[model samples]
Target: MSSITLYSLDGCPFCEKVHDALDDADIAYETEWVEPLHSDRNEVKRVSGQRAVPVLVNENSGVMMAESDKIVQYVEQSLA
Candidate 1:
């Protein structure tokens, strides 16, 4: 199992951005596709306290956060 997990939604630009960053950095991560409706994203909310896509959870480092730019920066500075 990968140490990182990305909560994402298909066709979401922000989610794609995070995915691309992880791919470019060659970081192996598991993708958990969330619901299309915000109300249905309970798992995301449970983890990050929000229903936002592109939320990343690094189990090994015990880091959980949202936002694409932040996640990309983290990948470059830490994971990559």
Candidate 2:
């Protein structure tokens, strides 16, 4: 399985949807909460070029994508 990482924040319906998809698919992912505790969130900003939740990073393919639907589709494809 590929290494998947997700940057998420609380109270985001989109992030919750992505999380639900991952859980439904039984896919494992590392999560990083890009909250205020993160002083240096440059990686998240760099990957997305902005602060966004549910930032899916595919380490196997070195691809970073933002957008719940796209992220879900990419996860499905990667798992397949």
Candidate 3:
């Protein structure tokens, strides 16, 4: 499994979905919590070039992506 860092916001269901998937796969990952404001997503934008919750960055493989379902699938296939 690659080194994973998730940029997420609290109270976001989409982010929670990724969290659940990672936990179920037993993938150890770090979280960088971003504020729920549009401007506060600069960090996410810097990494993924998008302002979206549940961005997953695989530092080892250099796979940076956004979207909850895709992140879940990546965790299952790559990490599992």
Q: Which segments of candidate 2 are over 4 A away from where they belong?
A: 36-41
The per-model lDDT (C-alpha) reads 0.94, 0.81, 0.89
* Tens digit of per-residue lDDT, candidate 2, span 1-80: 54888888777789888988888889888887777444566678977787767798878888889999998897677764
RMSD after Cα superposition, model 1 = 0.5
Candidate 2 local lDDT, residue 51:
76
Over 1-79, each residue of candidate 1 has an lDDT whose tens digit, in order, gives: 9999999999999999999999999999999999999999999999999997889999988999898999899999999
- Quote the positional error of residue 74 for candidate 1 in Å: 0.5
User: Per-residue lDDT for 66 in model 2?
Assistant: 93
Q: Could you give candidate 3's per-residue lDDT for residues 1-80 as a string of tens digits?
A: 43789999998999999999999888889999998897878988888888878899998898988889999999888887
Looking at model 2, residue 80 earns an lDDT score of 44
* Model 3 segments more than 4 A misplaced: none
Which model scores highest in TM-score? Answer: 1
The full ranking of all candidates by TM-score, starting with the best, is 1, 3, 2
TM-score each candidate.
0.97, 0.79, 0.93
Residue pairs with colliding backbones in model 3 are: none
